[model samples]
Target: MREQFPLQQEVTFELARDVGIRHPQVSGSFQVMSSNFLVNSFDPALPKFVLQAKYAKDLSDPRTVEKLELEQRYWEHKNVPWFLVTEKEISRTASQNIE
Candidate 1:
């Protein structure tokens, strides 16, 4: 039988500490089920990935863009796939079901 590993959600990483920095303001918040989904894999060969969700209109904001870039960089440093998910990508039925 194959060993099963459950997917993890809302994973947060301490970037400053990992990179040998002690900056108080430098932190990473990967919140899932609302704005982002940080999926982790127990298998060493499998890479972890992130799914960030945002409204179509919100994507145009400068702050949002900056946040997205930071997230992309964080994932890239770890060699993980980062995906953007907009409201248009989510089905109404599925959203309702989740709610």
Candidate 2:
């Protein structure tokens, strides 16, 4: 059976306090699609995704980098996929569609 999970935006977690992150831009879970038995064998609640959005210019800041690293480690420890999205990487077409 398939279940739907709502996308959470601008969410803060308790771990954010420890990691010095004010909040993450987006986070959610989705079903994993795989034909391999091992890939699909995990508990249903385990897979999740995190997205942190920043301006391209902010990526060079030391504080930003440090906070991002801490956030990455927090997600890594929990075995979730974490991604950093900068303005440069965003496509105008995608943004329009999302709107």
Candidate 3:
């Protein structure tokens, strides 16, 4: 996620893979999909992050939150703004495709 358009309905992997494909030297044949639920515009200013708790429920867990917070603090201490994206959504999607 980067600089989200709050006006858009979805910010999807289709968009990212399209971007990846547009670059001559980049890998273009990536699989892309969208969350079946929310696509938020969080804060409108900081668009680099997209919160998908509803799409993958466990993200809202207290333990997961604590772990994410701890990891975030650790990264921030070292001046890194990294992401911890969900794998379940993609995994479930792949499984669905197989079915």
TM-score of 3: 0.32
| Residue runs of model 3 more than 4 Å from their true location after superposition | 1-55, 87-99
Better of 1 and 2 by TM-score: 1
Q: What is the overall TM-score of model 2 with all chains considered together? A: 0.50
lDDT of 1 by residue, 1-99 (tens): 111222223222344335443322324643331225767778677656677777899988876675566566566765778788887998999989989
Q: After superposition, how far is residue 67 of candidate 3 from its true place, in Å?
A: 1.0
Quick one: ranking by TM-score, best first?
A: 1, 2, 3
Q: List the residue pairs that clash in candidate 3.
A: none
Which has the greatest lDDT? 1
Q: How many backbone clashes does candidate 2 have?
A: 0
TM per model? 0.57, 0.50, 0.32
Each model's Cα RMSD: 8.4, 10.9, 13.6
The better candidate by lDDT, 2 or 3, is: 2
Worst lDDT run of 10 residues, candidate 2, spans 31-40
Residue-wise C-alpha lDDT for candidate 2, range 1-99, written one tens digit per residue: 222222222222455556665543426553221111112225667455666767889988986776567556655755766667776787999978879
Q: Model 2, stretches more than 4 Å misplaced?
A: 1-46, 97-99
Cα lDDT computed for each candidate against the true fold: 0.57, 0.54, 0.39
